[model samples]
Target: MAVDKDTVAGIAKLARIKVDDAEQEALTKELSNILGWIDELGELDTEGVQPMTSVVEVQHSLRKDVIKDGDRQDDILKNAPESKQGYFVVPRVVE
Candidate 1:
């Protein structure tokens, strides 16, 4: 796709960026080159290539699922300035 100066200016406006008149021409050429490279990539042939997560063969080390409380009730409540039976006491702001 060919990118013109006007197109670059419009893109800059949509992105809320200020592009000088001299800079727009350079940006237009750079965008055109990027699009040309993308077009070239589209011409590659791939008959039966499967999608893969990693290029190298390696398995991720995973641990078994274990659930437990990280903190004790007494330890957590000790830091509170005012703690009730088993919770923190805070002033009510709403009526």
Candidate 2:
């Protein structure tokens, strides 16, 4: 993929990056090389390859779902700087 100066400038503008005139040329070449590498990778053939999350298989420990309200209102309110009636008190914002 050939990336021109105008294309690089457009990309920089869209990404909110300020690239100086001299740096823009270098950035355009670097970006083109990176895209070329990606294009080269697309040519490789990989058939029947299973996608893996990790190199080694791992079993995630999961707890059984049990219904409970974990209602420790007083405990939760203890950490609050200002609490009222088992709830954190915040300044009224309604106008």
Candidate 3:
């Protein structure tokens, strides 16, 4: 699970990140430590453990789907500085 400088450099190139020699050396050690920690987790015994999304139980309430058009055109237009029929009026940008 050891990470060398060349591997770090290759990873940096793939990720499109600029990693100098000093940064590559530092990242190599950091990545090696992370891989070592992951290897340590692989040694844990969990034969009968069930996979869980969360530590606590969650229940979602279901509601009936209703589709209706909101007829509040005046209410929405009140926020606009200028509305020509029912649309916002903007200054012409094109010549």
lDDT string, candidate 1, 1-95, tens digits: 87899999999999999999989989999999998888876678866977787989988899878875576889999899999999999999788
Compose the digit string of candidate 2's lDDT tens values, residues 1-95. Answer: 87999999999999999999999999989999999888886677778877677987788789889977777887888889999877788999787
lDDT of 3: 0.90
Question: lDDT (CA) for every model shown?
Answer: 0.90, 0.88, 0.90
The residue ranges of model 2 lying beyond 4 angstroms of the native Cα positions read: 44-95
lDDT of 3 by residue, 30-95 (tens): 999999888886788978998887886778779778867688999999999999899888999788
Q: Which stretches of candidate 3 lie over 4 Å from their true place?
A: 13-16, 62-95
| CA displacement after TM-score superposition, residue 25 of candidate 3 (Å) | 1.3
User: How far out, in Å, is residue 19 in model 3?
Assistant: 1.7
Compare candidates 1 and 3 on TM-score and give the better one: 3
